[model samples]
Target: MGRKSSLTDDQWVEIERRHLVDGISINALAQEFGVNESSLRRRIKPNKAEPKKAAKSLQALAEMKVEVDAKAKHFAEQLGALPFAKQQIVSDLARKLTNTSEHMASAAEISAASSHRLSRMANQQLELVDEVDPMKTRAQLESFAALQKLANISGEMPGRLAALSRGQPPEAPPSQEEVDQELALLLGSGGG
Candidate 1:
């Protein structure tokens, strides 16, 4: 017969609960409960069927929630302390960014759905290539190319929107009149 366990039934239950349900490490539990690590492992029989729980306990989640709430409150207080004009600018910039993000998300969803549908259609076309007319395949390829361009535009839209929100226009080649004026100013200054 095996040696009698020094721990009570209630203590064993608590240890198993902490290890399996609470996701606490056996070593840590042993250290906390002042029991031998190997002995604790032998006593606790983990169920093979049920998946292990996440390491974070309910108490930990509660503490994290409190910390996040405090931080958000502090941030709001800081934002409220800002001058009205600065606050307005901040709010406008936030609104612009949010709109840009929504547009990008919508574009992404459309592109993804279109791409998936095209892929399925393409697979079917490949199987029917010998029987189907070549014109239909060409049209499908063109549609795919258009979708790719749309995806590229969607990827670049955020940066373009951000630049516009910051009051910077997209760079363009200088006009001939502007270049002439610059040249004249440089020449006039050099002659003096």
Candidate 2:
């Protein structure tokens, strides 16, 4: 009585009867019939109810994930062609390969067991590369910034290595860090 619909009054009544028997939503019924959901709701829905919009959010998230995946794949493909970016060269003759093993680990058969072992080895390597070497007081493993300032001031790589080997911190050079450490030591040692 409120508005006209494509389906007749009898069809609307039957649709409502089916909806009751099936216990399905009017939107679902509309989707099943490939008709406008709003039109179907107006035609068949007897009880006024608010349709939830959660499905739209989930659909949007799915679309966002797809877009992210495509972008990542495209960037990875572009990066695959640039080989020089993957290696760090030291001493002009030796190069350290950085994570070329993603290809190996990505193999369809890199089992969880293998991954666990690989993770342990990787952690050990990271520690070795990042730890301050006790034998080499040159601060090679302390942090890259500290090492750079030491290299710039000392102008003697061999001496730096000797310093690191002696377990002495490479702090003789005038790094802002050294100044801060001096300040802290002075303040704490009651010399401030």
Best by lDDT: 1
* Cα lDDT tens digits for candidate 1, 31-105: 998888888865564333432322235447768999999998997898899998998998999999999888876
How many clashes show up in model 1?
A: 0
Tell me the lDDT of candidate 1: 0.64
- What is candidate 2's lDDT per residue for 76-99, written digit by digit as tens? 776665566452222123322334
Give candidate 1's error at residue 78 in angstroms: 2.8
Off by over 4 Å in 2: 1-50, 84-192
Positional deviation of residue 117's Cα in model 2 after best superposition, in angstroms: 44
lDDT of each: 0.64, 0.52
Shift in Å, residue 30, candidate 2: 14
- Score residue 161 of candidate 2 by CA lDDT: 48
